[model samples]
Target: MRAAAAEHGLTLDDERDLTPYLDLRRPRDRFIAALVGAGRPLPLRGEYWRMLRGGDALQWCLLNGLLNYRVLYFRPAAG
Candidate 1:
């Protein structure tokens, strides 16, 4: 990707760098609500986060340990 961008004489910055500006209004409000209501991370998915914030936002929250995610493992048993 860097090579491709360089070929076109374009300089690129990582999208992650821009994540800090993501609409944290919801996240902040929710975080406070969670503290007051449950005292835990509001359990949600990246999709919902995106819908609430916007594309490419909230990544910093996740990366910076301000948020977290879950991994679901499944198996098709005895195929």
Candidate 2:
């Protein structure tokens, strides 16, 4: 996996930092993947951002969590 990432110019200095994200890529998260594959929005957990955005899954997930929550429950996803 490290070699694959390195080929793409992605550095994996901390294993823990990316392991969880990789888990999200597996069959266990198949439902979410299927939803996105079908062009449907997820239920505001922001796990999808990790796939869409490159930097720090932790950070994107944090901000997107709240944003998705607000978008789903209170308003549209974007203005």
Candidate 3:
């Protein structure tokens, strides 16, 4: 990705340098901070935390749905 961006004369900043501004301790904290800062309702705070910590699979599904996914197939791993 760096190479691809460099080809177009665009330099991407490393994320490590922005940790202080970006880190909110956890996903839940970030969500709460954003919602509260925007003066939005807090009723969904717990729900947001649950959805985030649910698992990668659930997170993927949530993101996919938000992006208007049409169809998805899932198969359990063989034991």
How much RMSD separates candidate 2 from the native structure? 18.7
Every candidate's lDDT: 0.48, 0.42, 0.45
Sort by TM-score, best first: what order?
A: 1, 3, 2
Candidate 2 residues 14-36, lDDT tens each? 43322333333445345554545
lDDT of 1 by residue, 1-79 (tens): 5566566555554323444454544776566544434523566556655354442235446656666543333333332
Measured with C-alpha atoms, the lDDT of residue 24 in candidate 2 is 35
Writing each residue's lDDT as its tens digit, candidate 3 over 1-79 gives 5566566555554323222243333676556545454544444457655554444334344445532323222233233
Sort the candidates on lDDT, descending order.
1, 3, 2
Q: Could you tell me the lDDT of residue 38 within candidate 1?
A: 52
* Candidate 3, residue 24: how far the Cα is off, in Å: 2.7
Give each model's clash number: 0, 0, 0
* lDDT for 50 (candidate 2): 54
